[model samples]
Target: MSSPGDLPDAEVVPKKRWRIPWIWVVPAVAVLIGIWLAVQTVLEKGPTVTISFKTGEGLEAGKTKIKFKDVEIGIVKSVVLSKDYTRVVATAELTRDTANMLVDDTRFWVVRPRVAGGSVSGIGTLLSGAYIGMDIGRGKDARRDYTGLETPPVFASDVPGRQFVLRAADLGSVDVGTPIYFRRLQVGQVTAFELDKDGSGVTLHVFINSPYDRYVNADSRFWQASGLDVTLSTDGLKVNTQSLVSMLIGGLAFETPAASLSWAQAPANTTFTLFQTRSEALRVHEHIVETYVFNFTGSVRGLAVGAPVEFRGIPIGEVAAINTRFDPVTRQISIPVEVKLYPERFTSRFESGPKKGRLTNDPKALANFLVANGLRAQLRTGSLLTGQLYVALEFFPDAKKASIDWSRTPPEMPTTPSGLASLQDSINRIMTRIDKLPIEQLTASAQQTLDNTSALMQNLNTQVVPQATNTLAAARAALEAAHSTLLPGSGLQQDTTEAIRELTRTAASFRSLADYLQEHPEALLRGKPEDKK
Candidate 1:
């Protein structure tokens, strides 16, 4: 008010000024920033989903991360029990990148330390902590709520391969992810397996990847390659498939026949039989025309199913099975071995070479033929190391001549124990002979000799030895006295020297008398001739 009056000459305008409270200015700016950050966070959040977990063991409210193919795409915002309290529900805020990942086919699981298919995996979770693992999928419809898998799949759902079913005797050794090998190279794995429909065996579902699957054809063979295949044969010890990894993890192998004419490739879902060994898969098995039961009294410890039945060093059949039967009447146990003989094994040979006569199959004719040739069934050791025994057919002229025992259903053939049983018999005989020997008499004689020796020793020690000792002591004293006397001019030494001279003269006189008596015929009744003169 004083400014306009004071400035009389000059027209002065009041200066305009503006001021704000500095204390509240900073607070207003901070509030704007906070609002903006919240809006940005809301916009960036892709989706919210509820995941049900069997357990909430390794989860933390703000730390458990959700990953797809090992890439973190979301984080758990909260972890709590479900309404029913049956499972744990994890609420997650996913990144914008996972918008499409919330699909019907997507899978989620907890990643922790686990052992699957005989292999240890997810061991890193021991240190870094367990997190949620998600696998994305190509799904048409989107889904938010999901259930987590209890166990992880052996293979990813998107893996490219063809599945095949393999039937085997048992599935004890095999497990999921067990390797399937091709020529010892790992090319596939076991996906799943279950008992066969009939429950007689097991069926394994296997998947083989491309490029290697082509090798499996219609004529292909599959066998277990999960253990050491040591063959004890006459050729020598042959170790097959000694891979330590394959043996521990268990595995299967496939091979197509080299000389086979069929090379048809197997299609998807094709069925195949899994054999125990490669040789079993490759053997040529034919129909058995006749079944024979050999009631063997000999030991069949080393004999087993599939033991070869050889005739003249060539395999003509094989043992189908072995069992023990008790004859109540006889009160003895007998091993009944079922055998299958194929005619083709012998026919093929006769067709190719000497066709002098046809080997008849009639039971009576065959029995006569075997009897004429002295053919007998014998148990022979196939492998000494393993003690595996096989049946051998050979001529045994010295065998107890028994005619064909065709009265029984599966006519029992004339049998003999080959070298295996013979050696055992010889040992038994030697043991029996040793048992019968006169050990008692020998022991008695030895004791008598010991007693006689003891008595003689006692006599020598008590009587004869003492007398000899006294005699030795007397001779030693005499020798000492003689030495003392001979040292100087002792009278005893002189007397001894004179006595030796006189004995020498007497000996000379006797010699002369005998000489004179021999020269004279009429001496003494006849005195000596010199004395008579």
Candidate 2:
């Protein structure tokens, strides 16, 4: 090598190209893969959400999944206690596709084993561990932070149905999740209940599923079917039950009356009244009620509030109240019964009659006429077995005339004693008449007669009986003497036998003589000549 000079000449040749070491090639490839992975991780990432729960039970960071309709859509990244420590907060990462599903009304709850509302649910979580369940909301606003539910909803939002509201005097046995029945078939459930703000009643929210919702109409009557409805009336014992479940856990039943079946379907969230019984639900609504009071003189022990008030045998009203009033001056106690009468009930029957408008137009005149004609209210036994009494209006021709007191707040009607009371009064009168008689004197007279009879019997037993006995002995002696005289073996019998034989001989001689005389006399008489001996 001619040294530097030669090297300079060789410098014109291209310097050896820079070549990377094989070890570095491996590092380069690794760096490129790491960059690509970072970019992919960034691209696939989605929005983060925070969910607050009562507890951290069944949740695991990086392992717990967030699912909707059983499809995994997100995962829990971390879990920590809330600031106040009242709950646990979970941070979750959801795919980008689920970003729109986060809504104001979105629901989240843990899927775990739970028993409620007469049902067992979330059984699959026992094997798969618990997961966060999500229900998409119909809300318009979007949200990320959420409050999880302690329990799953009874119905999914997607379920096709309608809701309604019911007002009741009391909650009775009804509770959330109680079944609602249509003709004994379960068609819906109670979703919620709240006490009225005024504390006078309860408000219930119910949901009817799909096709069953169509059956609910504006005229539908709802009643509590929680227990057995047993009625003891003139028709006899009636026991009604909707179902075994209803009897045990309680339920609701609704039906449109046969006459109102053509009514329009009730819209969603329609309000309705919940009645206590089917009868009450189906009873004709009477808007025009007239209040009347009756002062009864007899005991009203069997008469109670709500007792039927009848015109003849038909019910036209009911007893609203029963009150006892004591007249201090007279020292007498009377029962004042308040009754609610539906005049329409009677008017409807005579709608086509001439008296229809007359009665409605001038009720006071009709009342006066009825009273003048002896219309009286009386307490009558409705059920002898139950000892239940009801009010009855009847025409009593013999009753004393009475008039209604129109000046009273509730007009006062005249009343008569019940049949039982009348009988009691008659018995009392008879007892009074008997009491007025001289009972002591009558008893004394009867005792005196008895004493005389006893004395007479004693005298007969002593004197008369002895004399009679002596006379009977004498008679018996006479009979013995006669019997002895009639004996055939005695001396008299022998003498009699001898006389009879002598008489026989004499008789034969006379016969011979008579025959001779008869032959001699036959010549003169021509009668005994035929006897030629």
Candidate 3:
């Protein structure tokens, strides 16, 4: 404080100010932020998984992304050869959200552009390149490794439907992803199909979506609906499924009979038989309680197992089989046809008592019933165009008497000859009767009678002509004499008048002589005649 020149004069040394350097502090904070970012980057990096594939086609490390539900979820970090150098192992880094999808049962497959089984898929991949698709399959566990599938599965785990199995003789025009129809409406699809274990046929696994699945019942029938089924029936050609889609890709359809209520909804994984046609399904069960064997001596070419068995113009059953063997009775190459009769089909609901019990159920009663009614089986033509033969049952009052023995194993029925055979028999009988006639003998007798008549006519012409001529000449001479006598001025007329006058005179003298002779005879006889004279 002493400063006055040193004296107490205020020493004004410019005030030293306390100012902060903001530039240096800002730099320190920036350096700390840089350190923090590096640590977080290391901590947030997700875990990786390894997948094995047959080939590394359409894959590139760090370039190809793995997706789920069409959303990008991971990237292929690396692709390398297996230790055996025979396969590829692809390592992928997934997002944190995919943690739950990492399960033991998870599935993975690459999505690529391709066509298979009549369907085109993975079209989006054409523009964006190929990708890995993942599905969290049927489990709740976690996994870090998997073996990817070469092809996509028929259905996703999340699809809602019921699966069933069907057995068919041959998979004609059927393929995976084929549409299944119900009343001409698409309702389901075929999932997987494989040849049967025993090589007998093929087995198909199909799925029907909800709502539509309810339509399937135990009694439902399924048949192929592909191509054109042209049936030349009596009515006309019956064509089926002419649609281009069906003809190309093929399809299947089902029908729930009117008696669907006989059973409940079909259970999952239910097994069924796939028929080739609708008619085949109808002829499935003969349900024949009464079996009768008919021996057909005629042609059985068109007769088959499904041939109709009719009774009095009503359908009663079908032909169970047509077999050739030595019959027990005929002991010849008789075509013993097994026809099954379904009595319930013919018995009306109005019948009751012993008659109500179907004859098919009781062979003994049926035999008696048939005998009393004089029922016999005969073969008839069902379709003239198809040449299909069928069995016909009818009653003939005076039919050749026959009987049925129900005690036999299969119960035999009285059989009459086929319609064609009966006609042939009648024709042979007529020919036999005509052959027995004496045609040659009759011709010879007729010829002899004509010769005799000709000879008689010749004799009359030669003998009678001369005698008749002589008689006519004699009669002509007599006529000439009579004509001359009858002439008015002829000599015969004058002589007749003179003769009459002489006769009158002679008659007068005879009268007088007679009177005198009478008197003289009286006088001579009795003297008294003299006086009278």
Candidate 4:
């Protein structure tokens, strides 16, 4: 019991005591409250996630946070290198509630910065250092670690696209990230490029979006859209320079308005065949044997390995390889071009059998077909500006047939084929020859011909016409005198009347004689002495 100021006593409880001093109790209670708070924080385990990237420039282990729509979900726990050493692995921790929200497809990209397609993104993240952007999908799974995707946010909702691997000869300074356009609209991009193993070709990796991919096919032709487009006009050709971006990076466009086939959706990582536009004329057949070797022993300055080898306006093969071999005995350098041909390209239309079971690559069968149809190989000009020669297969009904022996020395190739190049050269030669022709002598001869014609016409007009006119005048005078003497009408008498009747009978006889002479010019040559009546 404890006593107040008065002597009265109050009920006394036991003096309660803490195991420790009161001063220590205050700190002990505080320690318990702190422990309880730490436990509560530990129990609320946030979502756990991971992301892979090439670099971790602005990302930090403890500082970097991952958020979804500004709501903080998780924090990056650790940064480590993957086993492959090709990527950076970032471990993250999230709240329990947010942890179940991460689905397999949930994206955790490091939102730093990016610049492309004429747009700059993620500039806000630059100031905030680097943050893990968490696109948490709805899911119901216990908290676990996830191996994030290697690629960036390639939105599936965005127009799905296909990839095209184009092999071009002269991509000349074409860089990665080049835009591929269709009718001036950017439809794709050149993602990557590398020289082929042989260094003879360049393989270009191109990606095109959804419907744009459907436009290309086996026969679609592609050309570099660079420099300026030219159009012929009355004021000469007008050149319209394209955009600077298109000129530097150099884009590619295709046009093929033929039959449309089913769209082929080539999956990612699938390899599609690439063909060079310049080498499209080259035909290769694995099963076809070497048939005829044609010798083109002439200057091949502009010829290349992939040069067009045409026959009768048809592309039969390409110049696979070219070499100059000196014939020691003849002391002449001859160019030998090895050409690869696809005999299967020539189909036998004259097959009498079923279409499906028709004979294929039969030389004799095809030769007979050609014999009846008449086939010939003429030099065709490939490029007039470049003077490139290509063989063209043609049919000439009036051309003489020439036999070819495989063992004999081949004939010299024509200087120029009947191609555009040959036509240009022929025109030039004709102009040169005309300039050197003897024009003075031709002018003299023409003048002499004109003078002779004029003289002949003058002789017929003056001498011949006057003689005929005089004969006619004299005959008329004689007729008038005879008529006056014969008809004395009222001036003469009975003798004038008798003479007039005789004169009329004589005139009728003379008219009959003139008619007979006019009908027979050749009869004049069969001359007979005139009898005096």
Candidate 5:
């Protein structure tokens, strides 16, 4: 009964309060949704981050993110020192797509102003303050660990270079950081140096451009340069240079092509040895020692250990050792010299000569043979300029022993003569003999001889020569007159001139004949025997 009326009442009660406008509520909801969405995007994607550095040296995190390039891929979160205080590690966050760039061998370094010596480098970077320099080396192998390179590097693999080692007499004052140069051009440097354990050798380590490795080899000579310039004058040469700076701060130089060396693969560690160039002072031949401890007490002013030692008149070998010793029996200073002689080896070199097959291996036979041949040791001059002397073997014409004298034969082989010492002794003996001479008596004898010669000359000139000269002049005049008539040019002046003219005419004729004969050589063989004419 009230259905129509109830519908009307319910409608009227709902229209009583329209709580809020639909338009305002809808826009407000939309604004909230948009803000929430923006915040979520920021949390997931992050902002263009910035990493602060003590010196923001090599970082381009914002502008140059870790993407291919210009792609907003990743950013450096922060730059901070490691916890242990060793290094400055940069934390970087990669975008979803940029994560692939963090592979092995991917190194990062800070690029700043570098100054070595007075030469300054990277000065252009002063304006940019500093930057994060990257060295990208792709490793075929994958890596998850993030690591860094030991040092920021210059691109060196493509440079023209090689590796080599130098054996120096001394490292001199060379240090590890020394440069290696070629003709003053910077080519390489010294990486390290080590001393030999025996305290004998120093190993110098050096490297050159790789292409130049072929030039280093076995015969290469090395010398240390101490940056000292040397010049010569009348007082000899003077040098002004610093070896220590050369070792620590200066460099070394070498040459190739002009002086090439033999090449071989050196050890991983390169090393060279130095030797003293004193070969002339050391004997390297053959001889024999009669006794282990023998003394040669003699003057040896110019004698050297390596001086040649001779036996009789033949060069047996050389003096191996000369040393001082106090003999237990004699209790005196014994200057002992050791000699070496290789009879077999010597004979091999000279056996083909006139004395072929005569050299014997038997020591006694050789000794007897030598003594019988007037063999004696003598001093000989080697070089007057150097005052170097050598022992010589001489054969005296009036030697006592004509043949093998077995009666007084030496039980042991006689030592070969050392020329230097022998010469010194000879000079000493001559000086002694001269000193012992009676000067007054010798002077008186010389004066008497001079007086006698003068008297003989006076007698020949004054007493006998005048009359003899007059008689000889008369005889010579007659002889010359007779000879003049016989010879062509010895006659009167006119006759002499005529004769000379005739001779000249004859010579001209002969020369003409010779010329004709030369032109027709067969005419000589066919000519009539001179006088058929």
Candidate 6:
């Protein structure tokens, strides 16, 4: 090394510029590249978020992707059990481009095959495997922690449509994703439903797509179109349906009445009533309803709550309820039928009639007057085929005197026995009278008469028949003797022939004398005729 230092001094040149050895160059370049990569990574990294799910199913560390509209926006970096182990926590690394998309209302759910709301969805996920689906909410606030949904939304928030709320007595077969039809054409779907807090009804949220949403009006009528609507009315059997799908999966239908076509379009979030059938939804609304009850004492077998109450053949009301009450003191049960009468239905037809004032001004007074005039409610057979019974208000001039019980909560209208019931009563009375008759005594008398008749017949056969037969035989013998006596070849016949000849000779002599006398006197024309003979 000293010799090498002397040699360097001998060749003494200014210290060569300090330079990295070739072997070090490679390491330096690598370090520079590493720093550059780290800086780029730091610049491109986005906010990290944690998502809580019910389970870690179909989720894998660094493999599962979070997608928005089928485009990858983030990835699950790790999946671990939650602190309380009740759920799985997935930490995701999102791209810088999606840093602002993490919103409070943002929704995320695992995409899997599912059938709901009358539709099959996520069929594409079967081959591509399950992934986190996101729906960007229209919220302004940013959030990092999120709870994933168990089910995907029926529709994205950006879908152009109008939402409406429907109130129904029951949910029936309607559910989220149930189709909605307009004029038998599918136009919308149900988004969600909830039971009313009071538990009196159900409230459904429905969305109508853009063009179809415009068809909904303030006076639009909505009714269930699920299953087969088969009506057996006086007109005939009527079958109606929205579609085959509706019959299978259930659906709802809406229509705007012709009279309401000019009405304003319903706004988003409009509330409406859902009826059970199209007929009910489209029926004319009666503003004035009069409630009444009738105490019937007959079989209401075929009568139903919806049975019509008619005046003559015109429907004026419907049965609201049928109940039975027992009078403990009297030990009698009475069937109380509650009816809701649409008096306007009658008044509308008679608006310009002579009794318009009376009908419109004081319906109660008119009802009382009519009742006093023998207008009574009676059950009648509506359809013989179906044996359905309906209430009929008609004049019964011979009915017993009765009056309304106005003091009751729902005024009680007087009722008379139906024609069938009256007939039944008459039959029952006749049966009772027949039952009270002395049938046993009558039967004994009849048996005695039959026995006497049998004895008479036996006597005739034994004694009278034999005597008659003997008498008939004797008569036959007498007839044979007479016939023989009248035979011409017998001895008595010969004697009679001799006697006839003598008588003839005597008659000839008498005739000759008469002829001589007649010739003398020219009398006795008969004697002259004999002489000529």
| Top of the candidates by TM-score | 2
Q: How many angstroms is residue 253 displaced in model 6 relative to the true structure, after the best TM-score fit?
A: 2.9
Candidate 6, residues 178-229, lDDT tens digits: the string is 9999999999999889999999999999999989999999989899999998
Local accuracy by lDDT, each model: 0.82, 0.90, 0.81, 0.62, 0.54, 0.89
lDDT of 5: 0.54
Q: Where does candidate 2 clash, by residue pair?
A: none
Q: What is the TM-score of each candidate against the true structure?
A: 0.57, 0.79, 0.69, 0.51, 0.40, 0.72
Q: After superposition, how far is residue 311 of candidate 4 from its true place, in Å?
A: 4.6
What ranking emerges by lDDT with the best candidate at the front?
Answer: 2, 6, 1, 3, 4, 5
lDDT per residue (tens digit) for residues 210-278 in model 3: 788888888778888787766554233567773567778888877787755467889999998998886
Local error of candidate 6 at 86, Å? 1.7
Clash-forming residue pairs, model 3: 2-8, 3-6, 3-7, 3-8, 3-9, 4-7, 4-8, 4-9, 102-143
For residues 1-533, what per-residue lDDT tens digits would candidate 5 score against the true structure? 76765764444444575677877998999999999999877767632322333444465444423432223345566666766766656666655433344456655544557644223455656774544444445565544335444333433323455445555556665665466544455556665567767777677666666655545554343344446545332223466433444534655655433323345634333444332221221223224333221234554445565566554545555656666768689788855555555554455566454332325547567666776666654445555555544555566655565443334312322233355665777999999999999999999999999999999999999979999999999999999888877775554767878899999999999999999888878777777456357
Compared with the true structure, the alpha-carbon lDDT of candidate 3 equals 0.81
Candidate 4 residue lDDT tens string, 1-533: 65566676678889976576678888999999999999988897665566777777667899998877678877888998889998788888877787456765556666667765343567897677767776655455443556553333433223478776777665665556567676577777766778888988788877778778777665455556555556332123456433566666566655443433454544554443332221231223235534344445545666666565666556557667777788899898866666666564454333654332224546555554664464555544465555566655566676555444434333222222344445677899999999999999999999999999999999989999899999999999999987877764545678667899999999999998788888865557774346322
Error of 5 at 101 (Å): 9.4
Models, CA RMSD each: 16.2, 7.1, 15.5, 14.6, 16.8, 9.7
For candidate 2, the per-residue lDDT at 243 reads 96
lDDT computed for candidate 6: 0.89
